[model samples]
Target: MYDFEYVKPGSLDAAKSAIAGAEDGKLMAGGMTLIPTLKQRLASPSDVVDLGGLGDLAGIRKDGNSIVIGAMTRHAEVAASADVKAAIPALADLAEGIGDPQVRNRGTIGGSIANNDPAADYPAALVALGATVRTTKRELAAEDFFTGMFETALEDDEIITEVVFPTAEKAAYAKFPNPASRYAIVGVFVAKGGDGVKVAVTGAGPAVFRVAEMETALSGNFSADALQGISVSADDLNSDIHAGADYRAHLVGVMAQRAVKAAG
Candidate 1:
């Protein structure tokens, strides 16, 4: 890894200030992906602002109809939360299935969402659950939060403080994960709320996106049969060695059906 200064900020303001001060500073959360990039010499930030020391940015709270998760809360915590499991079991299941034991232990929710890997599980949960992403600046609806691959609406120094996922009537997440990496080849989150039905797909596209076609059909008939003729075209999907775009597209349909079935 390239030489860089490390700053362990004590508070939110301190972390923001440290990040804003450096010319090419970057916030370090869990270091699951950032450290690997640094070691590969892909990114060389002048300063690394470590958010781990900020004790305030970690917890799970019930806020009215939503469950609010602090930015720095680790995956394992979310997976193990009694409140989360009881109220939103599908979310807890998503967290429980992320990566492996080590990644679950070290990876933070904020870090995962910020990185926004196309195959990551959190984005699917956020989108379908109609969650709100809270940053140092403002709250962004989950649909508006994800801009594109590895990109978000966040400004340079704005850190994600928390995420608010509304309690849906029913919801579940299904994934066809890569055996080796455990990253979703195609993952879908299905939810039925007062607003109606919503379906979000990740791992198949450049970013997590709502499958409007599927959503409409499912809203009328919440069943595997609802997704019969619905198809995900391969024209704008991610194609890696593990799976091709067409295959991923096909998997999206399959996963969505599974999510609906599992949710019921």
Candidate 2:
């Protein structure tokens, strides 16, 4: 990794100030993605503001009907939290299915969502569960947060504080992971909530997206049979050696069906 000035700030304000003062600063949550990029010389930042020292951004709690997770909360913590399991077992299950035990123990939700990796698992859940992302500047709906592949609406200096996920009537996640990396080759998250049904898909395309047709079908039937006649077009999905767009499109249907069944 390239040499860079590192600052572990104890407070959110201090972190923000440190980042703002740098020529080209990057926030480091869990260093899952950033560290790798640095090692490969893919990115070089003038300063790395580590948020690990900020204790406030690391907990799980229930606020009324919603589950609020702090930004620095690790995947393992989310997966093991009694509150998360009781409120949203599917979310806990999704957390448990991340990269691996080591990754889960170190990777933070803020890092995952902020990186906005096309194959990331958290985007599927956030988009499907209709969660709200709270940042240092403002709150953004999940739909508005993720803009495109490896992109988000966050400003350069903005930091995610927490995520708020409303309780779902029924929800589940299913993914066909790339065995070598455990990144989803195609993943689907289905949910029925106050706003009605939502079907968010990840790994198949440049960004996480909702399937309106499947949402409509599932709203009416909420079953695998409801999706029997539906097909997702592969034209816009990712096509690489790992899996062709056509295959990913096919997996979308299969995973969606599995997700619906799991939700039930």
Candidate 3:
């Protein structure tokens, strides 16, 4: 990794100031993505503002009908949180399925969503559960927050404070993971709540996306049979050595079926 000035700020304001003052600054939540990029010389930030000491950005709480999770909350914490398990077992399950023990111990939800990795798991849950992302600057709906692959609506200096996920009446996640990396080859999250049925897919396309057809079908009958005859076109999905667009598209439906059955 390139030599860089490191600052562990105690407060959000201090972190903001430190980042703003640097020529090229990057926020370090769990260092899951940033550290690897630095080691590979993929990113060369002049300053690394570590948010670890900012205690305010690392907790889980119940807020009315929603579960609010601080951005810095680790995957292991999410997987183990009683509140998370009670409110959204599917979410906890998804967290538990991410990477491995080491990655789960260190990777943060804020880091995961902020990185916006196309194959990341959180985006599917966020979109399916209709969660809201609270940033230092503003709040963005999950749909609006994830703009594209490895991209978000956040400004360069903006920091995610927390994520608010409304409890779903029924929800579940299913994924076909790549054997080596365990990143999702095709993951689907299905939810039925106040917002109605939502089917969000990840790891199959360039970005997490909703399947309107499946959502519509499941809205009438929330079952694996509901997904019958439904199909996802391969036209816009990812195609690589891991899986072809056609296979990924096919897996989308398969995972969605599994998710629906699990949700039931």
Every model's TM-score: 0.99, 0.99, 0.99
Give the per-residue lDDT digits (tens) of candidate 2, residues 114-178: 99999999999999999999999999999999999999999999999999999999999999999
User: Which rank order by lDDT, best down to worst?
Assistant: 2, 3, 1
Mind sharing the TM-score for model 1?
A: 0.99
Q: Which is superior by lDDT, 1 or 2?
A: 2
Residue 179's lDDT within candidate 2 is 95
- Per-residue C-alpha lDDT of model 3 across residues 1-79, encoded as one tens digit per residue: 8999999999999988988898999999999889999999999999999999998999999999999999999999999
- Write down the TM-score for model 2: 0.99
lDDT of 2: 0.96
lDDT of 3: 0.96
Range of the 10 consecutive residues with the lowest summed lDDT in candidate 3: 15-24
Which pairs of residues have clashing backbones in candidate 3? none
Segments of candidate 1 deviating more than 4 angstroms: none
